[model samples]
Target: MIDWKRNFLMVALSQFLSIMGFAFAMPFAPYYIQQLGITEPTELKKWVALFTAAAALTLAVASPIWGALGDRYGRRIMLLRANFGGMLVLSLMGLVPDVKTLVILRLVQGALTGTTTAAQTFVSVQSPHNRSGVVLGTLSAAVFSGSMSGAFVGGLVAEWLGYRAAFMCSGVLLLAAGLLVLLGTREEFVRPVEENGSSMEDRARMFWDKIGPATPILALISIMGFVLLFDSAWMPLLVQEINGGIKGAAFWTGSLQAAGGIAGFLAGPIIGRIADRISPPRIGKISAFGAGLMMTVVGLSQGFWQLFAGRFGAVFCAGGLDPVFQIWLTKTTPAQSRGFVFGWAVTARALGWMAAPMASGTVAWMFGLRAVFFISSALFFLLIPIITLIARYLQPAPQPSAPIHAGRR
Candidate 1:
């Protein structure tokens, strides 16, 4: 067997650097929108939602195809494609002259990049069974740490140098990370052979057939996408509201974004350890409910401290979901089809992201921003029942090498 630890370190470092670059400019979207000259508060809000939705929508369409290709060719190639493609598009975003141009580029960006998900696929496939939980949690921590650093630095950069300069710097960092991945990573991919007369549809059916017992797990994964949409669309706006000003808004927003990362960074592995000891579905159920309750607290907050406290708890709980999902998915999936499963699962998440900003923005416009939080909180509460169903139904069938078990007793 290959030394999964070596592969983990290489991909983890690549993810850290690449996401730091992406987050550097990403958290300043509202400020960037203002720079493009639609200065009305409503217009700014809508544009923020639009830009986020544009990329997510494209990602929803593209991630599965990339995953399918990754399953056939190699995940390393997918990582390279995402990193290089992101470097090009993100850098060009710095030069766009208008909101329209910027939005167009963001659309292309969705299709071209998703380094985190790709990295997840790489690490998941490489990890040993017993260590998958710790490995995935560590990767999540690296992601949060990089994002935290980027948000903090990007805020300073946006304030000192300018948003365009921040974008350029982000592109440069992404390029460096891509080079590291190219030079350091090694894979022993064995290409899948096509049966002489089988069509794409037949092959796909065969793939699903191999993992038929894990279907409910796939459903649970899709629901996770929608759960995130509520937060993604509104979290920045929430920070700006909590901070109560335009002056130094970027810094405050970045600080809050960093806070979320800090929670994820600290809580992810701890929760992963817990999941390994107890049950991942149990962790999933409690975390989902806890996250929802915290979102409600955030909405109800009337001051900075209240918002801060609520956001931290919410993100802390939310951090558990991905690692648990990853560990569970890894356990349930056949080794050969891991990439395909992860890719399609990511596509489900992209769809939720695509719908979330649009829905959150429209809901905020129609009902109120606070209403968005309440609705999101309700969604999490709603998820508890679904998770219970998943816990009961999503049992893995007996594998020759690994024993099959349900997520709960």
Candidate 2:
């Protein structure tokens, strides 16, 4: 049997470092752009949006292609590619002289790097299906913890040194993550044989034919996009409303956003254990309901305490949903196709991430920010029915299956 525990720890550590690197630099993009001579407020906002949209679009386009390549080659190599690509792109970003150059680099960064998703592919393929919930959950915790820590560190570095300096530091952190994965982890990846000289189109069709049956999974991924969208677009406005006339509003807003990450970190393992006991689908359904309830509370809050409590509870509950989805996907997908399937899964979720915030932000702009919360609450409640559909497609995890062996590209 493979030493899954050791491999899991190594990948988890790498994920933390990779995410930390990302949060450190990416959060300071607007500040960095300001230094590049775009001083008008409207122009700054337009440039920021353009930069963000550019990265998201490229990432969504590239993720599945990388995944298919990983299935053919090795996930380990793909992980390395993402890390090294990030390190190079982020480091060079500090050297660029203009906003256009920075935007181009950002586009390449998105196309080349998706460390978390690639790392998940590494872990999911190597892990036993029975233990996937706990494993993926722990991984999720690492991600949240790293992101929270990164934001704090990034803020400090940006204040003390400079945004450019922070970018260099971010590159160094990703270098560490890459070294950890390259030196410490092991994979037994085995490439599927191409029998009967199958054409590329035939193989591509075969891949989707297998994935096309899981409509519920796709829906859930889409819901998560909205979840992220609501959290990103409305949380700061919610904090501002709660802290009317308060000093250090910015600090409070940061803390409020960080609270969700903290809650996710603490909740991941606990939720994973619970899912392992009953079923992932059951846990997912309950979590969606809980998140919806908390969203309603947030919509109705009149004070900081109520809003804080609602945000914390909602994030804690919703944190479990990703692991549950991974568990179901792991049980249902074949070992050889997991890299590609997860690639498609990541791409699907990225589409949500890319689109949801824009849609919700427009709503908040037209109506009130509170309306965004109410709409998000309804979306989560709608997820309950979708969660129920997942159980229909799931099968028992392959408990005693052998690990995938390392194969040539």
Candidate 3:
């Protein structure tokens, strides 16, 4: 048997590096776009929103293909492909002579990126069952570490150095992540079953069959996607709420936003085990809905402490929600279709992600943050009743007896 523990560390580190590299530009990207010559702050904000939307849309399209390919070729090779491709794009971003080129590259980068998916495949395919949650939780922390590193540095670096320099920093770090993947990782594709293994195509089909029956799982995932929307929109606005000035804004925003990831990192695994005992659907019915409400409360808070408390609650709930969601995805999904089913969740998350920020920020700007929060909170509360009803009426889907199949995409 392979030493799953040792491999999980390598996979986690590689993922962390990849994510941190991506985060390097997130907090500062808008300011950089404006500084690079946009001339209007409002336009810059719009442009930033556009970039966020583009990333979500592109990821929705690309994630399934990436997951599918990992199954066809192998996870480690596919990871290298993602890292190298992303590295090339980020590095070239530093050299782009025009703002338009930079914007185009940013859009392309989102389409090509698959850091989290790759990491999940690595852990799921490699780690033993009992250790999956712990290993994945550790990996989540690494992603958080990367986000923290990138955001904090992006803030400070953007202020001190030029935007070009910041891009260069992001590029160099991404290159390093690719290098780590190429040098530090190896694949050991675990067959879903010993006899009569299903083709990747078969697995994809099976995944879709369950998709309708997997309402609870999909709903939880869809909520996660929506949370991404809240997160992408709220984060920028939250920084402004903390401090009005756009300058030095990214540093603080990025830092605190990353703090949520840190909290999730620590909390994800612990919660996963707890959820396994209780069931992920039950946890999601509570925590996913609670995440939305608490975050809405954060938006409504008047002062720093109130905002902080709300943020703390939201992050805590979010931390609990993610691993539970992942566990539900794993449990509800059969082994053969696991990666592909995950891709669907990623797709749902991306699609919801596309809608959330665009609607939240655009509406919030006109209606005020409190009104926006109230709206979101109302919708969140509605989910509680919906979930309660689903639990009361829905029948459980059958788990794969021997790693059933989902036909190729």
Candidate 4:
């Protein structure tokens, strides 16, 4: 048997570093976008849209291929790919002459790299089936922690140092993290089933075949995409107080982002492990509904704290969704197609992200930011029904292949 604790720690460490690098680059992108001096609302929208879309498009398109590659060649190879490729693209941004080059390279980076999937696959393979939720939550915790650090530090650093310096720093951090993954983690081999286990082999073969079908897994992915869009809308929906400069816009903005990341880090594990026991669909429905209720209440808020309270709730609800869905996905998938399915899932998530800024931003412009929150809050209610349907109708996934289960999961 594997030393589960040692392996999980290694993977978690790699994920923490990789996620930190990604987080470092994001908060400061707006500063660069503003520097480009194309601030017309529509044009600004287009630029922001294009930048996010590039990543979304790439992540969406590349996830399955990365996942597939991970399955056949080795999941470790995928991690190395994400690590090295990420270093290359981020470095380009630091070196690029203009915003155009940066966005183009970012999109390419998104297409080529997916650290999250690689990390998740690594843990999933080594972990006991029952403990998947707990392990995934631990990974989620690492991810959120990295982002929390990045956002808090990124905002402060960008404000202090120049934008170029921040970009260069991000590239360096990502490169270092990737090297750690290459040097430290061991790859677990996945081979064809033994002849004695013909029936099991045939069933496992079928799991691989199921990977391509756009089934409930994809549905979950698509819904998650919209969920993020809804989450993104929250900022645009901050209401008249922000436009009036209630109490330092920069602080508020950074605080909101940091707070959400923190909540995600703290709550992700609890939610994920709960899903392992109570069934994913139940958890999904509850979280979606809770998120909607909280966000809608936010739209009704007049005070900044009220708005932040809503933000916290929404983040908490959404935080657990990733691990829950990941558990669902890996469990249902055949080992051969785990990469493809997970990849496409990431791609779908990316598309949702691309749609978010535009959809919320445009709607906020027309109807007001509050309306954006109202609409998003309202829209999320649909997920409640969607997940309930899956829980009620679909067959439960069979038990996982090994004693990977650990923790309460």
lDDT of candidate model 3 versus the reference: 0.68
Candidate 1's residue-wise lDDT over 195-217, tens digit each? 55278888777866655656677
Q: Considering TM-score, where higher is better, how would the candidates rank from best to worst?
A: 1, 4, 3, 2
Question: All candidates: CA RMSD in angstroms?
Answer: 4.6, 7.7, 7.1, 6.8
User: Which TM-score value belongs to model 4?
Assistant: 0.86
Error of 3 at 183 (Å): 2.3
lDDT of each: 0.84, 0.78, 0.68, 0.73
Residue 339 miss distance in model 4 (angstroms): 2.1
TM-score of each: 0.92, 0.83, 0.84, 0.86
> What are the clashing pairs of model 1?
none
lDDT of candidate 2 over 1-409, digit per residue (tens) = 5687888899899988998888776766766787798866456545665666666678888988998999988999999999999999999998899999999998899899999888888888888887777888899899878776776677667766777988998899899999999999887767789544278888767756768755567667766765655545446446656777323444454455467768889878888777778777788889889988998898999987888788888888888888777777776678787777888887777777767656665666577668888888888888887677556645546689677778833
Quick one: RMSD of model 2?
Answer: 7.7
Q: lDDT tens digits, residues 3-106, model 3? A: 76766777778777788787777666666666667746466556666766777888889888877666656677767777877887877877877677876887
Model 4: how far residue 256 lies from native, Å: 2.0
Candidate with the greatest TM-score versus the true structure: 1
Candidate 3 error regions (>4 Å): 39-42, 96-99, 190-216, 301-306, 369-383, 386-409
RMSD of 1: 4.6
